[model samples]
Target: MRALFWLLSIFALAAGLAIVARYNDAYALFVWPPWRLHISLNLLAILSVGLFALLYMATRLVARALALPGAVAAFRAQQRKQRSIQALRDAQRFLVEGRYGRAHAQADAAYRANESPGLAALIAARASHAMREHVRCEEWLRRAAEHDREVRVARLMTEAEFAVADRRFDVAAERLDALRQGGHRHIAALRLSVQTAAARGMWGDVLRLARQLASHRAFTAEQAAPLVRRAHLESLRELEGNPEGMVRYWRQIPKPERNDRGLVRDAALLLNASGQGELAAEAIGDALDDNWDSALAELYGRIEGGTLIERIGQAERWLRAQPRDERLLLTLGRLCLQQQLWGKAQSYLEASLSVAPSRAAHLELARLAEQLDRNELALKHFRSAAELTG
Candidate 1:
């Protein structure tokens, strides 16, 4: 409607102009040095109008021609972007569908197409690793590393994990050590590094990494404590036959942690194996202060210079505190047998059996009865023990 209004207005102005031209009879005269001409005002107006139309058309044609190349380039760039997006989608679909071979192909195509090279390289690496293609995985990981320096640490860490998965522990360790030395000690990277070190029996490195992980809360105290202790234990084991060095290594552990039941138990067993019974007993006693364990009870029972009566008294005290504790009752009964308190031993053994019958408890009780010359009771307990053991 606006265009129509403007067109009618232009027509009315032209008619008014024509009427004015008729009345005035004015003409426009043109002179070039060699020629002179004259035209009616209306005709000149018409000619001017036609010339303006021609100029406008020509300007539009020139502008369109000027923009053609850039327009084409932009269109082509958009098409390339679309194709790259499609390729990435296809690669992701293949990966999700467990079509690793196709995923590899699609990722390679995406990479060659210059579509997010880093992402494509990562996809190819993961797909190859899934297929157990270690060489291909490494190549893709290396390519990813070369493409983006910012992701170099992450790529190298991935390669190290793959090496560890492939049981190439030495290579994994080398890569991990290099990354750590370069200050790329991300938590996952450090964890894999520790595992690699452990696989290679590098207990010192394992201990160091475990401590670092523990400090950062990457692992819980309970989880990391054992690994640290095991690393120390292995270090001590390596120094076996060198008693002085072993003792020094064992003593290096902090008092509080060294006194932990699990750590102390393992240390005691190790010391005992190395003919360090006195130290083993001391460690055992230290562990027993915090927690009572049947294994520790048995270990304590084997020590000398403590009479059977004293040991029995200790076991009875423990049992009194936990009357229904079958293991403690059994231990007490065995201690009583050692002290030749046959009646008390029988009573404790019967209580243990009533709480939780076990072949071992029955056997101990039968042995005690036999020693006390209660033949009938001994025979019956022996038959029960035999039945349970069978």
Candidate 2:
């Protein structure tokens, strides 16, 4: 369709030119001292149009010639820019590949080539850190901050990570605090805070940061559970010998955290050790009622100062649900002995041994025998527990 339109337009243009030529019969004459020249009006018009077209073409050529040097320089600069970008990419790839030396070299070259110097310096810093070049790592990190003010947070994060790696908890804590105060507490910053807190044995801080990370979905439930549990355990251990402090700490822990069986058991054990057996018993009972844990039930037996008869009643209630749990049986044996129910204590101890012959059950049986004045039977039980230990 376009070709047909162009064909018709060409014919119409030719017919219009023919009509103008046929009607334009006027002429023009010019005279000089020795020569005279005459030309038709149509011929004059054609020459003038052709002359303008030639001049336009010539001017365009000259302009292009004049601009040639700048165009060449621009092309070279573009090539250099591409090379610098490629160098940065290579640096990142090498860093991921664990080729630290190569990564550092590429990053430095990219920095020299003026391609995101701040980012390049950060990559170099990471490479230096991987190579165990601590001094160089710090220098690169400083250079990164100097190159771009916006990258200072990134610089601080890198420094904090390095400090954590070096076990320099104090330095890491300072950097992390600075990040927080600057309103730059991103996921990575929070994760580094967790590491730094753990390194410093600051269990409270570790727990706080870990909970923050978990809330952000930075860690899966599986990963977060153990870390939170460990932090809680360590915090409970730190509160040892201070029953008041342990009680305060326990109350401060979130209810969801207290729901974890392992964490609850650790806290209960710590509480019992500090002569807060009532607190331990209460915690253990709450946890077991929510979700039964055999290990925690066993820990229930070791608590010293709680009402033994009440604990025994609680264990029996749990027994209705878990009749075959040997740990619960062992706990019942111990709780019965505490209440001086000699017959029931012997029955639970023997029942626990029949289900699972643990050395602990043997020891409990020996103690029960001693309480019953069966010296020979106590000696035999002691010998059997010794063999199991060996």
Candidate 3:
């Protein structure tokens, strides 16, 4: 259609020029002194203008004719590219929907058709992973890595996760080490490293990775504390066969972290074992100041003092600060009973039961009432304790 339009346009232009040449008359009105000329002015001017226009149109036609094949080639290439992109998108959708087989097929087709081999390999790897075809996943991931080092790091990280899922701790650790060595220590890599270290019971490695992660702000301080505490405890536990080694290990932990409940508890138990009651009591006191705990309460009650009064006084001080603390109240009541402060002990125990009734509280109160020669009240508290337990 365009060809016909150009042809018609050229013919009309030529005919119009011919008509102007045939009708218009040119009379030479003047000449320069050294020159002599005679011409039909309209015909010559029209023919010159028409020839220039024709030449321009002809040149344009030649250029377009020459470019037509390249244009067609480019258009076809674009369409093919579009198809490859569409195939990749479909594969991604299929993978997201968990249709692994279809996703693999689509990704394979896209891989063959697309120029972005790295992206195609990624899709293929994901599809293979979803299908549990680990061998195929590794092959595709390797292809991706070869295409780009950034892609390689990403592929290795994914592989590490898969290894961990398969309980391949050693392989996961190796992969994490490679990632860290390659300077690809992103949050995901650090997190996986932490998990792998923990799974392998590599406390040293766990502590190192956790500290790295915390330093990078990958986890909040609160989030990382428990893992750090656990790692420290595990390290200490390993030295249990050697008393000097265990004590040295305990001493090495920072004072602030040693104040944590888990570490404090472990230290108290260890101290009690080593017959260091005074140090254990001090540690327990520090731990309770941070948080009230039933275990700590019981541990405090078992410590030796001059008389039960001294212990009871210590507990009453704790209760004064935490008035509604049932655990402290119960502990204070038990200590008072031992000191023969029956009225104070009974009132405190009753207050504890009123706030939060428990088998332990009832039993303690029953024992306190018996000590006071209140047999009826003692029996009643004992029955309540039994019912609560049952």
Best by lDDT: 2
Across residues 354-390, which tens digit of lDDT does each residue of candidate 1 receive?
A: 9988987888887987787888878898899899888
The C-alpha lDDT values of all candidates are: 0.81, 0.89, 0.81
What TM-score does prediction 1 earn? Answer: 0.75
After superposing candidate 2 on the true structure, give the runs of residues whose Cα lies further than 4 Å from its correct spot: none
For model 3, give the 10-residue run with minimal summed lDDT. Answer: 301-310
lDDT of 2 by residue, 216-331 (tens): 99988887888899988887787787879889988888788888987887778788889888988998898889888899889999888778888899999999999999999999
TM-score of each: 0.75, 0.91, 0.72
Residue 263 CA error for candidate 1 (Å)?
4.6
Tens digits of per-residue lDDT for model 3 on 1-390? 999999999999989988877887765545888887777787457578899999999999999999999999999999999988888888889988999898888888888885567777888888898788989998988888877744677677777988898899999999888888888878998899899999999998888888888889998889888889889878867866676776667667777777787777776776656555566677778778777787787667666433466567777778777888777778777777777788888888888888899898898887877776889988998999999989
Model 2 residue 241 CA deviation (Å) reads: 3.5
Error of 1 at 359 (Å): 1.9
TM-score of candidate 2 against the unseen true structure: 0.91
1 or 2, which is superior by lDDT? 2
